[model samples]
Structures are given as structure tokens and as C-alpha cells.
Target: MAAPPLLHRHFSNSLSSPPLHRHFTSSLSFPSPSMRPAALEPNLFISPKPSLNLSKTFASVSFENQRRKPTSFAPASHASDSEPESRENRVGEAREAVAEYLQKYGASREEANCVSSNCPSYLSMLIDGVDDLDGWNSLAAAAENVEFKRKVSQMAEQKGDKGVLPFLESIGLSLASASRLARYFSPSKSNALPRLIHKIQARRGGLHLLGSENASFGYLIESFPRLLVLPLESCVKPIVLFLEVVGVPKECIRNIILLFPPVLTYDIDTDIKPRLRSFEKIGVKDTDLGKMLVKYPWILSASILENLEKILDFFDEEKVPRSCSSQAIKSWPHILGCSVSKMKLIVEELSKMDIKSKKLGHVIATSPQLLLRKPQELLQVVSFFKELGMDEDAIARTLGRCPEIFAANIDKTLDKKLEFLSNIGISKANIPRVVRKYPELFVCDVDRALLPRMRYLIEIGLSKKDVGFMVRRFSPLLGYSVDEVLRPKLEFLVKTMGRPVRDVVDYPRYFSYSLEKKIKPRYWVLKSRNIDFSLKEMLGKNDEEFADVYIGDGEVLVPPS
Candidate 1:
């Protein structure tokens, strides 16, 4: 094969010279004075040398020559007046100069003029810094920047599409990126560049696939410009449809692609669908797939039986219930991508702290994300709770109830929860009791969950001290929503049941009862029978036990069918 284009070789040599002046004078010159040199005239092509202004350089030389001697060829009166005519002659000479140079290198008159008009900078880049020309085509292959030439040449070499180089450059692809993308595929495909460019234009609408945030579109393209060349129907569409079908919103699609562009290359049937099926088979619900993808889009492309099955099988071996298995893994599918050995390491770390298999499984089922976090981090959280005076057994229990506390900011969440309790007069000594009794309290938002319920209790006539004592006694009250649970039940107790404010303060556990199942039915039955029951009697007993004790051979009236 002939060596690649000399234009590339010549330009590379020229650009490597020490200074701007050396690029033109040292690397390039005219064959004869009759053939006007392109270097002395900037109009032939835009000079690549930033500092060498062609007209100024030539004019200064002309001025020095004029000072050295009077012109013998021109009459004395017209010598100075000939300057304007000389400039016009240079402009006329520029077009002929460009044409003659390109023609000498095998371009026809039309090709020469077209090349000059369209890419004026390209010829200067081609020959300005070049040296030691071998032949008419020598400049074509003389570029030291082989990578860029190879990229542009690959497109031009394709049958019927010599315009591909300029076409590609016209798009946003930089020459460096084009060269890199050229190497991303095989060299034998002479038609690859045209096909790639055609594919990009064919799927031009894919730009809109990045959704309302066009900013990510730039990022996605810049990150993986080659993705534009992927087969729209065969490659990109299947992955897009799979994600959309799985509930990844359109707005999130760009971010997913940005995070994992190789996902587009995954074989939809063999790679993507199977992994998706494995996720579903492992118990990740379709509804939760969106959440999973948002957090770890790479999971969609993870090896199914290799990665996901290892997690599911491990959970099975740990006796994670079949019912809870899907919920657990869906809670954090990113952990499914973690090496099983790393998961075992996490489990082993937890076990060292006395949180063993069953407890570990339960904690994982509730917060499988725990498997994503480092075992060391979890241990630190455990130590933090321990520093708060909780023993191993208490921490283990707290993990079972609120595994997310291990993931939360202990400084913010744990301190805030303790601080709220302290403010409510629960005392520093009693915080562990509150946490041990209700670990969920540490995870609940203090502004949203804790304050409103306590305030509602005071509104219903319990003193602040009495409400604080009730919370310390039954810490679960911190988990109930005031608008949903506490307020309605208190209204019923005060109005419907005619229970005095004093009675509720005395037995504040009344807030913990299921208002629908226990409070409403039992209270209705007792009230209808014209019998009175204390809050404790009504709430403490199961239905059968309450009926056996309170009804006393009279038919235990059931909740009205």
C-alpha cells in the first residue's frame, strides 16, 4: 500500500519547527521566482503561524530594499506610485499561485479553486512547515500526525464518500476525538466511516432522547462521541426500550447513558433482557426497578447468573425468606453488583460484633444497602452507638429494627434524635432507653415526626412533663404521625368515649393502640352494652380474651359486619 497522504506528513514537519518564521522560510519555498511563492502571499491560504503576518513581513522587506537603492526598471516619478498597483497585482497573483501549486500536485483547476475556497487553512497546514518534498503526492503522506490523518483518510477512503472528512469535521467532533473513535472499530471496513456518519444523521433525534436537560446531551456526546455511530435500531433502541419499559423515566435516561454508555452496546436479548429477568426472578419488582436504576444503572448490565444469583443464593443459604428476598435485594440492587466475597466480608465483619446469621439476614432484608456499605463503615456506626452506651445486644436489636441508622449521618441523625429527647427532659441517661425501645426514632425526622405529636398531646390537656414521661415510657409514639394517628384517637377519647384528660395521661399507652381495630370496635361494643371500660382494659387484651372477660356469657358482640 502507498504511504498515507503527503499533506499530513508535510504539515507535521512544518508545525514541529522551532518558530513561526522557520515554519515558512525554512520548511517551504518556491521552485522559481516566476511561480509566486505561497509563503509571501497570505491570501493563498490562512497562515498557521500566529505571529507571521504575511503582508507586513513582505512589505517591511520591500521597504528596506527601496531604501537600499532606487528601482532601475521603473521611472523615478512612478516608483512610489506603483505601490497600489503592486498590491492589486499580488491579490491577482494569489489566486493563480494557489491554483498552480495545487495543479502541480495533481489537482485540476476546478479541484484547486474549490479546495482553496473551502479550506483555505488546510493547504497552509499542509505545506507551510513541510521540508524535502519527494514528489507531487509526497505532501499528502508527509503528516507526522498520523492519527488525525488516519481518521480523516478512513472516511475519505470509503467508496463514493470522499467528503466524509469535511462532513465529520463540520459536526461537533474534534479531530482528536475522531481519531480515537476511528481506532474503536476495525480498520478493514472501508465503508465504516460513511456508515457511521449516516447512522448519526439517521438517528439525529437521539439528541432529544437526553430529554429536557440538554446540558447532559453535550456531556453524553463529548464522553462517548462514538455512540453516535452505533446502529440506532439494533444497538441503542433495544437498551432504551428496555429501560423505558422497566420504568426509567425519560428525564433520567440521559443520566443513565452518561453513567453507563456501554449499556448501549450490550446485546439486548442475550445481555440486557436476561439480566432484567434475573432481577425480576430474584424478586426485584418492576415498580422498584426505576429506583434501582437511578441509584445503580450499571446493575442493568451486570452479569445475571454470575452476580445476581450469587447474592440471591447467599441470601437463600442464609435462610432469607423467599418472601423477603426480593424486597431485600430491591432495596439495594447495587449490592448485587458487589463481589460475593466482599458481601461475605461485610457479613463476617458484622458477625464479629455478635450480629450473626439470622440477625444479619433480617438487617439485610430491611436495608440490603447495608451490603453496599463497607463492613468497616458499619462497624464504625456500631461503635458510635456503643459509644452512646448501647451494648452489643442492644445495637444488634437496633439494627434489626432500623438498619438505615447504620447508613445515616450519626452526627446529624443520632445527635438530633438524642437532642430532641434531651430537650423534652428525657435526660442523657434515658436516650439509650428510648433508642433501645424504639430504634426507629433515630431515623424519623425530628421536625416532621417528633415535635408535632408531643405538641398535640399537650393540646389535649396533658402537661409537657406528663407527655415527656409518656414518650420515655413508650418511645414508639415518636414514630406515629400526629395528623394520621395521635390526633384523631385523642379526639375520640375525649369526645366519643367521654374519657377524661386525666385518664389518658395516666395510661398514655392509649396512643399505641390501633385506633381502627382495637379502640373503635372495643369501645363501640362496651359503649353499646352500657358498660364502662378503662383505656387499659379496652386496649391491652386480644379480641377473644377481651370478649371472654368483659362479655361474661352474654354474646360477645362483634364489630358490625
Candidate 2:
């Protein structure tokens, strides 16, 4: 009922500002080594701000456009007596300052440190005041999203003459991007593009659409420059209206166009509607049309639909069930974007590796993105596992169990996960067994997912050694959450069920049972009957088995109404 803590209030206020706009061209470079953020959401408890390096938190610009870094994007502080610290050194010092400051303001030390180290610029923004405090908070949010920062930073770093295509300049496209468009679209050695550009500007929906409220105009133009040349009435507007008629939400029109601007180039009767019909034929229910269009608007694109048919034909040839393929498309609509030629190569490679043809359909359904991966990348993942002493058959078994391992990147995905396992006390020797058993563990996030669960386990009373053994016994134990699954179940086990925490160590699978349905209902039945049961015995039973063992032997007593 009470208002949240000051840090939470401040974060909420700063995170709700106007989205980034054009005309914010400034260069910024930070030398901090990347560190992952500890908590997705900062702790809401109140605490004093840390005063470490109180000398320099507010040295950058105040919360405004052009944002946390100043207009010049210079170092946070300067020197009068001696040379200023190296850029890396300054980032390091600021990271320490922000991490400590965040901890004092209710973030756990892990959360603060991870955030501080990952992007010191974000932490620097907390102290560096931007100009327009009321409207520029999303700059802080941008610091958290690496992709958003890349886009914004790309716009901000544009260095061009002010005299470039004034029409696009007026509507937020960077001059560099506009110039590229002019050169690329104009094959003739003539000044006709500038004239064509102004003509499009004067057209009914051309410039107006680019400048429309809520359009991601810069990103759209950068991604698909041909939108600048496409006619407003004949090409673009009809498609926009067609989407609304087809049940894509009115609000989603801008996003659909931005994602697949070439949709404007497709013929409605020949290309667009036919693809929509193909989608319907494949069991994409009428109700899911809007959601699918928004997620992968290119599902209806001309080139993608061509590939979609090829992939679907390949599925039929491979003995894949029609129902499974249909569901796979429904779940991951972008699988339509994959090349069927590459898929054939992957199937051959998989066969040589002993991957079963029977399991391939289900793998395709579960890991649709795997079809998009290069064959060399799959080999790299296989080689990494082979180094772990797994034979090709064992590797195929692991893939059949969790195909996501093959879909993942070996260096970026698997190696980092292996490091996280090592950091958490998984021995180098036993990691292969754990990997084969719980291959999903490689897909888990090190900073956000795995570390937090392990830290909570230690916080609740499990020693590091106890957790290591527990995770080996039931590899999925780390996948359980501290707040949702682990904490509530542990409380019930110790306080309500009167069982030792050692029971969890002995039977880590106890976390897998649903608390409300299986665990609590069965435990209550046992309590009413005055019978003691081990966690494994209590949880590891089917309904009929459980009823026969306990309820069949004794009536579960009912309280008087």
C-alpha cells in the first residue's frame, strides 16, 4: 500500500521519458569491459546513496537529450594540476562509484556491480544530469537495452554536411543514411534523385507517412531505403489499409511497415493475399493473424513466402507430420525466412552425425532457429561437446533431448555457460554429464538466471558444496527460481511440513512438483492420515499410485463443516 522506495521512484521517473528522437548527433565512447547486470529489477528497499568517489558522479550533463554524455561527449571530469586519468581508468573509477552508490540505495551488491561494470556510461548517467529532466528519461532505459543504444548511437554519431537532403533531414533520417539512399537508388549519373526526393516529399502520403506520429522512421529508412522511392497511393497506402482489413491492429501498422517496408512493394492480389491464404491453409488460425503479422511481418513478404513453400515441401518429403510442421510455423513464424537448400545440407550433416530422422521433426518444432544456423556453426557446437568426451551417438542423444544446444552459439552461448558452471563449483570432469542431462542449462543466462538462483540457494542455508551435489543429482535444480519455486517450497518443507532442508539436497527433484496440486494435496492427505513420507516417495508417484499407497490404506479425514 505504501509508496515504493526513493531509488525505485527515481528509476520509474527516469525510465518513462520521451523516446529517443533524431537531431541528437553526438559521439560517445566508453572503454569499460562488459559486465552483466545483476538484477533485472533493482531492489525496492530504501538505503542511502553510496558516497564513493563523491568527487565526480555529477560531472556529465544532467538528464536531457544528447543525454548523459555531454554535447562534446568528453571525459566525466578534467584536471587543472595533473593529466586526467586514462579513459579506461575513469570508467573503472566511475563503475566503482556507481556500484557502491547503487548498493547503498537498496540494490544487492551483485546487481549494482554487474550493472556498473557492464556499461559504466549507464551508471555515469545516474550522476550526470541531462538538460531536459522532464522528457529525457528513456536515455536511461536505452542504457539498459544494448540494441536500442546501438540504433540511437548510430543516429547520434552521424557526421554530415547540413546541406544534404533537407526533406529527409526534416523527418529524422540522418544525412549519411539519406546520402546513401540517393547514391544507391540513382543509377543514372544525374541530379534526378534530389528532384525525385522533393517530388516524393510533396506526394500525399510520402513525407507525411515518414513523419507520422509513432513511426520508427529512421530505422525504417536505414533498414529499407527503397521506401523513399515507392509511390504513396499505389504501393504503400493500400498495403497499410489491407493490414487493417486483415485484422492487424491499427496501432501495429507502423511497426509492420517498419519491420518489412518491402511489404509496400508486394502486389496485393498476387503476392500478399496469396501468402496470407497459404498461412491460413497451414492452420494459422484467423485469430492469430494480427499477432503473427506484428511478430514477423515479413511472413507475408514475396521472397520469404517463396522460401516458406520450399521449406514446407521439404518437411513433407522428410516424413515430418503435417500437424508438427504447422505448429512449428505458428510458434516461430520467421522459420519462413530460412533457406531450404541450407536445410538439406544440415539434414545430411545431421545424418552423418547419427542424429535420428524420427527426432528431427520434433527438434525442428522446438528449435526452429536451428534451421537458420550455418552448418559450420553446428559442427563447432558438436566439436565442443566432442572435446568433453561425448561420442557422436551420445551427442545425438543430447541433441534429441535438448536441440536448443545445437541452436546456440558455441563461443557466445556454450562457453559462457560452461564458465558459469565452473564458477558455481561444477568440476571440469563432471560438466559433460550435467550438460548431457540438462542441456537447457547452456541456454540459461549466467548473470540473470543461474547466478541469482545459486546465490539464493546459499542465502537460504545450502552450502556451496551442498548446491553442487544437488545440481549434479538433479541438473534442472538450477533452473528453478528462488522467489517462485525454491523459497516457497523450502518454507513449506521446513516450517509447515516439518521436514529437514537436507530432504531437498537428497531429492532435488522435489522442486519439480507443483505446490498447489501435487505436493500440497498429497502432503495434506498424508497429514490427515498420520503417515510420514520422504519427499521422493511423497512426490515421485502418479495419482493412482499415491492413492493406492496412502488413501487406499486409510481414509483421509475431513474437517467438520
Candidate 3:
């Protein structure tokens, strides 16, 4: 089994505050510690930053325009004096109102049930408001392109004389755009026409003004005409408020709405909160969740149980350590949306290379995006390595060390990196051995990483032949950076120890050692006793072995201040 998380121990010992898990809050209102659940929901916590006043931002919604007469189904003329109406009676009345409205609109029974099933949220909006049917008109009349615009403009003016007509004209929506809303928001059926007008008012004054030339209101309305009819407070405001509360800037909300309009329709309590809680439980932190939502807003509408949780359950069943699983998911939340069948196919493909059970789970934990790659793409990466002379066993071993090779852009990226090595004079025959030893080199930039490091080696007095031999022996040197890794170690050896460049060039593997912990401390310990040692003699031993051999009868030098 893998060792326990170092993070948990480090956090507990170093910090006086509570654990990060406890610091998280539900996407609902911020609650105190006592009010929080025993195990807090994942990723739902608010930031430590001051909260924004979302109520003020959303206060302009005008519900008054939606007011109308009661339902067409009047109450029974002769009521029993003994019995009062109950919840069932209200539901029945609401159902009748929906049935009558659907009938008037010439909807088939199948169509009505399908529509009602798609929007379970409609019952709540229709509860008390179903009584008002005064605004209902003929579908054909309401769909008249000219009449719809004039009526919408009049409704817009009734609220505060906002003049939606001139605003629309100024913004210049094509006729197809106006015609789409006219057909979808007909006054002849439900109260959708008036509600559509109210929703537009909510968008004004915010950055998403219908009058703004840059606004995409025409595209959004044309794409999801039904969105205009959703109740502002019950259906739309909760989502907008939740997103704002989670720190999505107001300007980005319009783009999110346009991209994933169903976010406005998903039930805040039943659909959204539960899915977010599930994501949190899987170890996606609050900050990660917020960023993921803003980037891939469609995640809000994706099936949580089927897509996200199933993949996590697979990891748990395979005994991938929780911390590794958590970090991987946090890094790539979109992996959560990959279908279980696709993941199974990937696992099966990896099995072809003899990676199964615990090792498979471990590989996934290290680089979960491997599960997101197309099986064909993964096969191509394996094929490329095999074509370069690595057998399946060698490829599998290399993959164990750096499974992120699965994410490489094989045809383009690997080719470019190999071309760089060829240009640098590393013979083609030596390339496979170097690559097998350091597969991660394929994932790096040749210009930024490989060439610069090679240039520094030649500058330091190693011949091109010697440099190529060093890389063939220890391929990882090319992966090190000139400024951070190679240069600092070389500078320390030359300036501090007075070692000549020739001595350092003999063992390029010295660049791989930790300078402060291994090189500096060990050098000073040997120097204290006037003993000289090879690079292998000084650093090749394990810690306890080195301590016994070097500090046998003398005090080791303290680390320099």
C-alpha cells in the first residue's frame, strides 16, 4: 500500500487552524462550524474574500408584468361545508390548468407529458399563478411577427417605459431572431409571453443589456427561446445568485448562460446543490470547482452519478490511494465527465500492455487524463515508442515512471522533440536508449529545455561527443533547466569547492543531485576531514550508510547560514 498523505501530517503540525475540509462551506448561505455537517460537502466552500451583494445585483427583475387572471378551471360551485381543500386539490387544479393550456395550444398528450417531464420545475411556478389566464390569446395571432414585437414593446414600456422596441432596433436583431422568440413565447398558451418580457428586464442594467451592440442577447434568445419564459426568481435567479456567490465575475455570467443555458433551468435544491456536493465528496476542492464551472459550465448540467461519481468509484474499488486520486481529479475535473464505458475501454487497452489491477489504478491516479484520451490516440503513442525500437516490456516500464506520455501529442510533439535531438548531433542509434531511460523528455520543449541545457554543457568545456555520451548514459540531464538546475550546481562546484570544469564534466549525473542537501553538506563533511572522494563515493550511498562512513569519529560541518 502507498504511504499515508504527507500533506495531512504537514498541515496538522504546521497550522493552528482547522483542516481544509472543514473550512469549506456549502454553496448555500455561509454557515457557522456548529451549523456545518459532520463531513463538509466538497468544493462548496466560499472563499475567504468578502462576499458580494448578489441581491442588489439581481434586484431589478420585474415580476409585476407577469400578473394575470386565475386559471380557466373554476372551483366547484357547491362546496362541502365540513371539508377544507388539501395539497392534493391544489396539485389537481395545477394539472388541469396545464392540461387546458396544452389543449388550447394543440399539443398532443405525448408532447405535454414530455414537456412537463422535461421541466419538473414548472409545477412550482404554476402553483398560485395558474389562476391568471387573462393574457392568453390565439397562437396564430401571437405568432404574427409584427404583432409580437409591438406587444413585447408595450409590455416593456408598462413596467418603466424602457422602450424595448428602439433598443432592439438599435442593437439590430435579424428577422429570424425576432421570429424565433415570437413563435416560442406565444401569448396564446401559458403566461410565457409576459414572463419573457420580465426576463429581458432582468438582463438590462447588468452588463448583459439587450440594447448594447456587443450583447449576444439575439443569439441566446434565438438558440434557447424557451429560456426567456423561465420564471426569473424561481428558475433563473437561484443559478445566477449561486454562481455570483461562488465568485464568478458578473460579466462572465452572460457567457456562461449563453454556453450552458440549462444552468438557469436545473433545480437549485434538487439538481445543482446535490451534484456540487457529490463533486466535493470526490475531493474536488472549492476553488477548483469554481474554476472548472467557469471554464466548462456544461458540467452543471452533466449527470453527476453516471459520469463523475462512477469514475471515482472505479478508482476507489481499485484501491488507488485517496490523496493521489484527489489531486488528479482536482487538476482535471473534465475527466469526471468521461463515460464509464470509455474508461473501461482505456483500462482494457492498458491491459494489453500488461498493466492491470493495482498498477493500473496507480497509473490512473498519477495521470487520470489518460482515461480521457481516445483509445486510438493512446495506441498511437505506444506504437510510436515501439517503432523507435522499445519492446512492449520496455514501453510498459517507461509508462510506469511517466504515464503522462498518454497525453502527448504524439505525431506533432514527439516528432518535433526528436528532430531537435537529431539537430543537436545525438546520433539516431542512441536516441531510443536515451528516450527509454527518460520518456518525460518527449513532453518538454526542445528550444526552452533541451537545446539550452546542451549549449551550457558545451560552454562548460565538455566536447559535443562527451556531452552526447553523458546524455546516452544519463538521459535525464536534458530534462533539467539551465538556470535552475544545471547552472546552479555547476556554479556551486566551480565557485565554492574550487573544482575545475573537467572534474564536473566527468560525471554529468552530478546535476541530478540535490545541491543543498546532498552535494553541499557531504562536500563540507569530507572537506572537514581532509578526505577526497569520487562523485559516486560521496553521493551514491544511502543516508544512514553515508552518515556512518563519513562522520565516523568527527563532527560534520553545519549547513552554511
Q: Candidate 1: list runs displaced more than 4 Å.
A: 1-205, 231-238, 280-291, 302-305, 312-326, 458-464, 500-503, 525-533, 541-550, 554-561
Which lDDT tens digits does candidate 3 get at residues 444-537? 8877777778888889888777777777778887888788888898898889988887665567778888888789988987898899888778
Q: Over the stretch 445-555, how does candidate 1's per-residue lDDT look in tens digits? A: 888778877787787777778877887888887677878887798788888888787786668788887788678888987887888778888777766677787787645
Clashes of each: 14, 8, 8
lDDT of 2 by residue, 1-561 (tens): 111121122224321111111111121111111211122113211123332231122111121112112212234332223334554454455556555543433445654454344443332343233212212656646544433223322322232211123223333334344455434333231333233333333332353443353234444454554444445567766877788887888777876665455567678998777778878767887677777787667576555566667778898888877777777777777666555676787777777866534577788778866776778988999899999888888898888888888989777888998887777678888888898788889899888999899888888788888898988889999998888999999999999998888889999999988888778888998899889789988888777667678888544323211
Every candidate's CA RMSD: 18.3, 19.0, 18.7
Q: Model 3 compared with the native: what TM-score? A: 0.58
lDDT for residue 473 in candidate 1, whole number 0-100: 82
For each candidate, what is the lDDT? 0.57, 0.59, 0.56
For all predicted structures, in order, the TM-scores are 0.59, 0.61, 0.58
Displacement of residue 80 (Cα, Å) in model 1 is: 44
Candidate that would win on TM-score: 2
